[model samples]
Target: MTLRVLGIDFGTTYSSMATLDPVSGRATVLRNAEGEEKTPSLVYFGADGTLVGTPAQNIMLEDEEEAAWVFMAPKRYLGDGDFVRALPDGRVVTAVDAVAAILTKLREDAEALHFGGPVGPVVLTCPASFGPSARDALREAAARAGLGDVRLVEEPVAAGHAGLRDQGQRLGNVVLVYDLGGGTFDAAVLRRVEDGYRVVVAPRGLDRCGGEDFDRSVYRWFDGAAREEHGRSFDASDGSFNSPVLRACRMAKEALSSKPKVTLRGVLAGQRHKQDLDQATLEGLIDERIAATVRLSKDLADAADRRGHAIEHVLLIGGSSRIPLVTRQIVEALTEPRGLPEPLRLGATDFAVAMGAVYALVALDDMAPSAGSPWRVRAPGTVFRDVDAPWCPEMVVLPRGRFQMGSPEDEPGRSNDEGPRHWVEIGYDLAIGTCAVSFAEWDAYAPRGSERYHPFDHGWGRDDRPVINVSYEDVQHYLDWVNDRLGLTGREDRYRLPSEAEWEYACRGGRETPFWWGGSITRRQANYSGDYTNAVKWLGEYFKRTVAVRNFVPNPFGLYQTHGNVLEWCEDTWHKDYIGVLTDGSALVKKSSPIRILRGGSWNDDSRNLRSASRNWFPSATRLSWIGFRVARTLIS
Candidate 1:
């Protein structure tokens, strides 16, 4: 059996877990020791020993002084050491350790429940508002837990998956996550890409301004009222003086959400003090905080829109969303500002983050065959695929082989460039695009409407059709962009126009013939002008121009349009014949000619010109309707 995946929402104030059977697509929230779905993110260290979750919380309620040594909401202290606590044995624990301890406990419990074995991959969720350092600390903490491989995902992005999983497909891809937690607030815009969500908009957030702040608001109101009744003010410098009120107010706040009013009692200098807290008054006190959180969401969404990332839906996540005011304000702020469609209200708001993390694991599993090579996707019925490259075209993997290049002198429809049938060896496997690179793929990196980025499409079918009117120089720019996107994985330099021999070997698809499927070309076999098929006697259809790629049969290597469609550019410079070409399948670069080799005749070419052996060349800067190139990725061994 595959190791189970558990999503850990190691939140600021509360932590939750969800076990995912990725293959089955089932996710269930796992309860903590107290049989509750959520556990307080508190850790206690005292003379009695270390304790966590409900037990740590239980000691806090025993006495204000006992809770002082207990760490609560350690997530806020991730970056700083101000909150570091010293154990009785003189060992110190930082925020990271406290978090690790919590996770270790959660892991032990989950494994006891057999989250299918002694170990499983864990996906940890964090607020999107967390920056690189803060997020990095989260990973470090999980590492300390001795858990399985850990993956990180933003809290809001996780919530978006949790809310939208059943929607099947989306009309618009961008989603905004509005997360207001117990100790932090985050608003982020995530774009749903092929396998997972991409953080298009950096999240906006406050280190504070959470449910705990609301508790403080109610506490302050009660303290002011009690002080006025006593005709004296409570000392603010004494931390102990406020601890009791803070604890009572937190409970009162939760109660006020359901009750019209709740009476909170606290002892001040040996006297019992009671204050009546009303829902209306509590709402008034925290209204500004709620509005500020809403403003942050709109501001982040607006910033994303300015950067060309539009918000299509808003996903609400966090324990604080149980508050009606928070949800109502978020709805109004996100929906009206840009008239985006109404946000999807998340079901089971508390578990959304954890559930979303499980979904993230599933996505990672689909995209990656192993832990190390995540960018590659291994699937049946086709060659290897590059799932990570944005705007990546479908590609087929062709293994190394020795193929005879060019055509025999006696072959029908042979050009002079096709003579001297010579052997060329391709040493490395290639990932060739299944079709010519489309306009949609090109526009993803560079849109046509911009004056700076054109070689615009000539009003031909844009979707799935090869992007034409692009010069050799334009393809170079696009390749540069693709390589940059490949990043420090050292896969950057592995993509280029196929060398002429490599192109020939791939187009032949392991066959030595005029075409991959025997010498005869037909309209049903490709998108080219097939009327002049003298080799076969049948009058074929004339498409007039390029049609949607792959409308015809694919070659033996699972590559489409290898015989016709658009003539593809090769890396080699112009060569009149195969006389001086390298025998090892490298492209021949000549500094003298401004032209490069073009192969696999276009849809506008005659049948004789559509032969696999036919070849042509044009100046490097030439842009023509019948010319578009496919990308070939060098397999990184």
Candidate 2:
């Protein structure tokens, strides 16, 4: 009798499941009842008290408070004091319960799709930063979903396993894994030895950062402008944010990514307020946040360096990695004086984790097979051991090779960021995270006594949605804590910011095109403003704010939300002219000035800012919602 294993990548913004068919030897992504491989991590309780997915996400738009259903993210508070309380009815639900529902849905899908027997043992991926309590919560959630045995795996490790398996590549030395998600960021350095992979350092992460903040930043900026123009306060306290008008404004913000402009129209206290939001205004509003993410990335590198370990290459992962600003910031930060070789190129962002999960499952099975298994597994001599020092995830090794880097020039609607049109050579290999970071990962490295340590945000929503309102300094502190715990010197050169060239090269996934999908940016292609396209009177009339990550399609490289989620940070000093610089793809930081480059466009940005080559700058000291970052490592042969 063959046993079936299910792997779950329970993401903050989206959730997905995969399984290895014992008979077919093929991995398959399970589609929900809606016929989609991924499901929104949302839950809504109806007046009849029923939970829903896309439908629930819709209802929350109109009756946000009373919708009794939350959309996007709600998984950050698994073992904390946080609980989702339904107002009026006062029905309280734990984060575990909410996540259990989604898990149960996945289990149902697995059972329905099963060709042999029921799904047996299960493996779930978590961020490397998850502490004991958070891991316990996941175990409990899995138990509640009726799984007999549950094994926890770090998301990056799973992604690494999958990536290596897919590419038939292996790592021979210590490598770093950098993971950025919709709500959190994490980093880890691991070494591959004769005994298998062992984490040489404790993973580090930030609690309150991700793509969601970008949306809110854009929304708040636009809300402030609307209030100023209409002479009416549109504060969340004043119910203006909750009003249909403000919601409409948010819708417009989401729409602008693909369209030239979007309009926002609504009544403010019986008065009409209508505004046309150009791409420039939207980019301007969230510029500060973009800078903050860049600063955070530098701080993370600096913190790692302080511990005496030099990161070999920087790994980039997460849906938000697609933004042009993200790539540019990374290039500026890590690239060298003239040019040597572009830092190692990882695959696309979105698929790294899922693919990693697949790889991990195969690897694990090969190492420890049940008795009487007939499969001819590779590396049968491999032994399995738990990552003892607080496992988060693993980074996959991306071998240097010649793969298609961009879409054909004849492809319609390609953006400049996609290309001046060229085929470039990536000569070196690098490691990348198998999946995006998670809330559990953030809590592991949270400052014990810092103000940012609180598990839940009373002013905002839930703890699991991703911690926000953190400064670049805070992110550095978290990285430092991880370094201290691991007894490793995090050298500046070893663990540093990724150059812009590295970021874009990874995001392109061997394809050059305006968007990751090889054409124009669409709502279905990514998480930006498509919902408002049909609702507003004009294309420009939608509102602004960040939505969830995983709300869009993955680029050819399997990365998600690269174009419009949150701007990411890169490790370069701000410089307008690149004429004399080295094109080898290393990062440069200015010692005198405390500013860094921010890459990627956010949910609130227009098409122009979303272009692959667009650049933005910010002070290193500042932190805002619309910005976050992924990480990379140098290849050590």
Candidate 3:
């Protein structure tokens, strides 16, 4: 009966729901009332009552005239306020009302089958083509469905999240998503940053082209042949969707994927018609549509290339992407120049977007358990080491609190990007390394025997000294190694670099002064050069070489060398200022950038650079002799 989060993919033709599996750290799709992974996004209104899912689909096929009451593809008109219809009971239905009905069914099914009550946070997925109005409509629909404050994610971006979670690869790769659903086609390019992927190129897709169009073509071919045999033209019923002819045509299209030919039998315009459609003929009918998708994918590839990122993998998602012809076209069009591998075809194409939405939910809303649950809560200054890897850096638990991030304009040596100071709330307890990661810890992961990059160490000796000459990218490999050793590889709770906000908050240690000790810093307090002084009281001393991380006195938070020693890499992309940065203490990693934030100060920097609010940045791949990093652990309660 524990509260759980849900991710719902609201597709034009079908809908799916998923949640994070705490045990495996993977997304698990939830089955609907009929025990199916996917539910048809159809609603039928009749004199008896309202019907959804399979029953509604059955009713639609039973009577084509019911197309007036049966609603399908409501997703296509999400933001169209003018789109309104009336039901048999004399009730007016708008696009929002129809979408709400579908979402309500999904939520109820999940609660009944899994949670036994209302779930926790919900993440709803929509097409990338959705504008601000469409996004607002989706939120309004969820609200009407009784779902509280839900998060919104683009369908293709959610699919990208799922792809990365399933693969469990380290970050820094470019990927493309080709999504062909029942009523639309979307192609998006993404770059895998930190814990998620960012859209490299805005998504491009056709609003009115998808599997339904193919179904219409099959209906036309059969209707034309039937008219010729009967020697007469008959009355025309509803043009498409909910019509028995279109339903039969859709069934034939699916069967043709695996079968050499499929028989389509139906009464078109009151005339009984039956025909066998071969795969080749069906391919010819939808060739132009598939060609359109291929052209869109090529454009994305070229855009990524122009941005200096080569798409490493292409993921095919949504129902229509299952067609063999779609894959053949994508492979031929995208395999040149770099010999890109064949586009990946997921087995659960219908559920990829939903599952990916779950992964994104975990990334954005993940939190540790409360104190005294499965995870133990310890007081501040409590230092511990992982039992599995005793050589891991020692971590000290830090208390949670709110603090003003960034500096005031009046502060000495304040940078323009540091102003516009904002309040950041560190809501959960965290454990940060007592000092910067040492050379000994780095060597334990990539030893002399391994082929990993070995820093020069500036001939300053290795062991207990802080690790230097390391790039931001190199630090990620070490963290991955540590997580693997502790068996927390892809879980919500793992070792990672502290976010910039967390770094500044920890450095302050509940002090409002420029330095944690006071407004002035002395040579005896930290490991920075004293030749230049922010305040003249303590000046005229300098250490040209790096010192051991723990050689200095600990701050009020029991953290050592937080003010100096080595510049620590923080987990955030560099921005001009804190104008629109995250206020929740989480990393601001919306997009991938070559530059990343760096905190603290190095051995050769003046005292001004060692202040708690001082900030700096460097390219992620740039290795500097003064740059190193500390680790932080998410304490799951």
* Number of the predicted model whose TM-score against the real structure is largest: 3
Regions of model 2 farther than 4 Å from truth: 21-26, 62-65, 114-117, 167-175, 190-200, 233-313, 335-348, 365-637
- Tens digits of per-residue lDDT, candidate 3, 21-120, equal 7787778999999998889988886777777888898876676567678788889888787888777568888889889999999999999998788977
Deviation in Å, model 2, residue 622 alpha carbon? 46
- Residues 1-637, model 1: lDDT tens digits: 2556788888877899997655666677998767888988989977777788988878777766676678778898875646677664576779998898899888887877645357666778876556444655777888898864776666766776676664544526777778878888876666666756555544456667788888878888888888888865443344433655787888898886678889999877777789888878988998988898888788778756654668777777776766778767866767866676655556678888898777766654343335563322111112322322237555666656888899988778777887678988886546677778888888887875764355555677787788888888899888887665543123533567888888888888899878898878777777666466434545466777888775676776667788888999999998888887799977899888899999888888877777888899999998999999998876542
Compose the digit string of candidate 2's lDDT tens values, residues 1-637. Answer: 2567777888877777777755666556777777877777777744566464555666776564644445246667765745554534556667787778778877877788653456765778777556555766887888888875566666655654553344333332534555666666555554453544444344556554555555566567666777788776655452434535444655665575567688776565777767788766766765555555555555544533543445454556666544445545555764342232233335545656665565455554333446553322112112111123332323333334443433344554333333443344455544433222223455666634756553333243322223333444554565565434432236431323456666666565555555555545554444334433112223333325544444444443434456665566777767654444444555656678677776666655655455455556778766665665554555431
Instruction: Rank all candidate structures by their TM-score, best first, as comma-separated numbers.
Output: 3, 1, 2
Q: Which 10-residue window of candidate 3 scores lowest in summed lDDT?
A: 366-375
Which candidate do you rate higher for lDDT, 1 or 2?
1
Q: Count the backbone clashes (under 3 Å) in each candidate.
A: 0, 119, 1
Give candidate 3's error at residue 481 in angstroms: 52
Which is superior by lDDT, 1 or 3? 3
- Using lDDT as the measure, the top candidate is 3
Q: What TM-score does structure 2 among the candidates reach?
A: 0.52
Worst 10 residues of 1 by lDDT: 375-384
Q: Model 3, residue 564: displacement in angstroms?
A: 35
Model-by-model lDDT, in order? 0.74, 0.54, 0.79
